[model samples]
Target chain A: MKGPAISIQDLHVSYYGNEAVKGVSLSVETGNLVGIIGPNGAGKSTFLKAMLNLIPKDKGDVKVMGRTIKEVRKRIAYVPQRNDIDWDFPITVLDAVLIGTYPHLKLFRRPKKKDKEWAMQCLQRVGMQDFSKRQIGELSGGQQQRVFLARALAQQADLFFLDEPFVGVDVSSEETIVKILKELCRQGKTVIVVHHDLSKANDYFNQLILLNKELIGFGTVEEVFKPEVIKKAYKGQFAFMNEIGVSL
Target chain B: MAFIEAVMQYGFLQKALLTSVMVGIICGVIGCFIILRGMALMGDAISHAVLPGVAISYMLGINFFFGAVFSGVLTAIAIGFVSQNSRIKHDTSIGIMFTAAFASGIIIITMLKSSTDLYHILFGNVLAVRSSDMWITLGISLIVIAAVYLFYKELLVTSFDETMAAAYGLPVRFIHYFLMTLLTMVTVASLQTVGIVLVVAMLITPAAAAYLLTERLWVMIFLAAGIGVVSSIVGLYFSFTYNLASGATIVMAATSIFVLVFLFSPKHGLVWKTLRVKKKRASLV
Candidate 1:
């Protein structure tokens, strides 16, 4: 609890002998809303997955709350990209959210009434309480995203990793998710998001981590949002945001 | 009523009926996961791959069920290893491994020159199942059913989203192999009733029909088991009445039910969907 919430040192990942994340090292303090922004295939998602040990890493050292990721896995929650989920999976909104409690329950134990009540509370937090009984496939894009957020909320995790949470979501859902994320941060939780839209990056995240197969910048938005850092990461395509005076 | 009475008169018929029903429930329950995970072909492959195990077990004078189950699990792991190690897709690996295993079984059976009646193993003679075979089937069925019951949530979570299961520290790889082992046991247990050639039908058709009828997994499983039991009972009756191959008759019965559901189910059937479209167009006009 005294050190950074998440600390990674000299991380390297390879896919079929080609390095995706190359010697990346960064630390995120607790209670910060951080955005990892990069272009396509920039290892932004790979970094998060490697730190979580979701994917195999060639070389890395990652610690959460001064302990190994596996040691404190129960305190961490992850929301995969929308594409990673199968919409046709035969589960209700409430069941999907209740999966968050599986880490706490024993192997043969079912979700108790208390677990169901807590899941309902989490669903209410994301305004998905009304859709708890609906089939997952029947929900709209925003509703689905909110359901996933509610699942993460059910975990009551101190650290959260969301991959492209705003993709295909409605404007209102996007606003709602960001508001909830800020609220989580205010509650002393560390939230890391794999984001693509640089225009809204400054407004959405208090901290910025610019990456492109390597660490380009890691600091507060005011420090890491320099025009040079953006140009370096996006290969000069994003220089217009600065010239247009968009306050990025 | 007379037909039922006549069929129930023979002890062999009673044994076959019990075995068929037991196989039906086990295959139907496990098949829900099989079809839901899009592993219908894997079920087919594993079932076919068991033939060599049976042949080799007979040659070695051992329990053919153990041999068949072992071979089925080996085939599953081999398929996984090939797909994971090489560029070949999973289906292709299944195709390669199962075909080779099946061909080897055929060769082994042909070379043995024994009075083993390989035809019974291939096509199944459910009426010929002895009391020992019945007990083995019962034990396997109970284990499979119990495993499914105790680990239903883990199986659902893993089959639905493997990455999330691993993130939750659910030992995903172990669960996967365990499921494969259960599938093998189910396949072996079903061999006496449905035979190698038609076992996959028992593993897929009823479950798929159930999937078409329900929006919930538990409902799908129960529906699948119901469909499987009905198919077994009806198919057994037809086989008795017409003096037909029991395994083929059972498969046809299950397929007929699937066809009916595919065309006429109220929610997802093609006919209802087309009718709804036409009604909407008429209203617009």
Candidate 2:
């Protein structure tokens, strides 16, 4: 429980014999906002899923809070990609957030009023308490993302995994989500985000993980956010950097 | 007046009414999860797949409910296993399993009993309901209601977002199979009223209509159950009065309600959408 919040050693994944993530090993300590960054199809999401064991790993070991995932699953929370779920489902924002409390409850037990209060607080943190009574499908993309974040928060998890939280999200909601995730880190929770926008990476996370189907770089923003490293991971396709100015 | 008098005077008529209503309610309740999970075709497959069990039960001289449930559950599991373990999609597996089971059932039933018995199983004859069949339907109804009531959140989460459910360490596969089992039971219970061919109508139409009426699952369940109960009552009334086939009448009733909701429900209806558009144009003018 005292070691790195997440530790993965030589993680590997494959689909149809083609490697997706090949030998990814990193140690992320507690109480930091970490970002996983790479070009598209670099297996950034694959690494997270492999770590969570949401998918099978050809070879790897992941330890969260010095414990195996199966042993400490309750202490973990995951916000899957926006497209992973049916947004048209007949669920209110509050009810969706209340799912966060499920892991802590006994089987066949509904969320109590106290848990409802906590779920509301989580929604309040993301500035979405006003929409608690609304159905999720009526919300904008950003609002939907925030609802998912609020759901994750209701878990009161020590380690968080968010996959592409900003894809298709409105700008203000993305800003709001980043603020809440940083605040969670300050409150001693480890937050991991799979983010694609390299321009915002330097400002968003204290710890950076540069992945390209492998661990290209893993360290502080100053140590690994270099243009050379980005080029190596992106296979020297830095032309996009010319458009966005790399922001460093 | 005649229908009401018939219902009160004849014990068998009362039993038929009760059985269909129970079938209606459970189908609506369980169908909410089924549609929400995008397993409507699976519902169809299970309903048809129960035919083999009915045929086997007839052969063995045993109650058909157990045989029906056994065959339905087995078909459900087989569909799941084939889909999960192979490149074939769920719809493909469902098509294969249901047809095979249904054909075998027809062959066996035609060989064992006269075609008249086969006609009743395929088309249903609620007016001939027996005491034991009614009791079995009641028991299964209670179990479905209790299971849904106790595990509302679990079912909701799993149905809406399976990955999140798995992340919470809920047994996602177990829940899937558990739902399949409940679906089979509901399908089996509906045998005497809707028959295997039209049981999927009771299972899907009411729930889908309710889906357009509300955005909350609890409200959807209640609305669907209400719709189902009404359909059963109306279908039975017409069937008894006109000497029509009960199964077809019940399915038609449910489908008619679904059509009305599709056109006129407040939020997701075609009429409402058109009305809102017209209102916006008027304001611009």
On a 0 to 100 scale, what is the lDDT of residue A163 in model 2? 96
The sequence of per-residue lDDT tens digits that candidate 1 reaches over residues B1-285 is 765797668888889999999999999999999988999999999999998999999999999988898889899999999998888999999999999999999999999975356787777888898998899989998999899999998999898878777776778889888998999888888888888889999999999999889888999999999899999998888888888888999999999999999999888999999999999999999
Q: What is candidate 1's lDDT per residue for A1-248, written digit by digit as tens?
A: 55699999999999889999999888999999999998888998998899999999999899889999889888999998998888888789999999888888887899999999999999999999999998899998999999999989988899999999999999999999999999999999999999977878999999999999999999999998887778788875566666887654
Best by TM-score: 1
> In candidate 2, what fraction of native interface contacts survive?
0.78
User: lDDT of candidate 1?
Assistant: 0.90
Q: Model 2: residues >4 Å from true position, as ranges?
A: A239-248
TM-score of candidate 2 on Cα atoms, chains taken together = 0.96
TM-score of each: 0.96, 0.96
Scored by CA lDDT, what does every candidate get? 0.90, 0.91
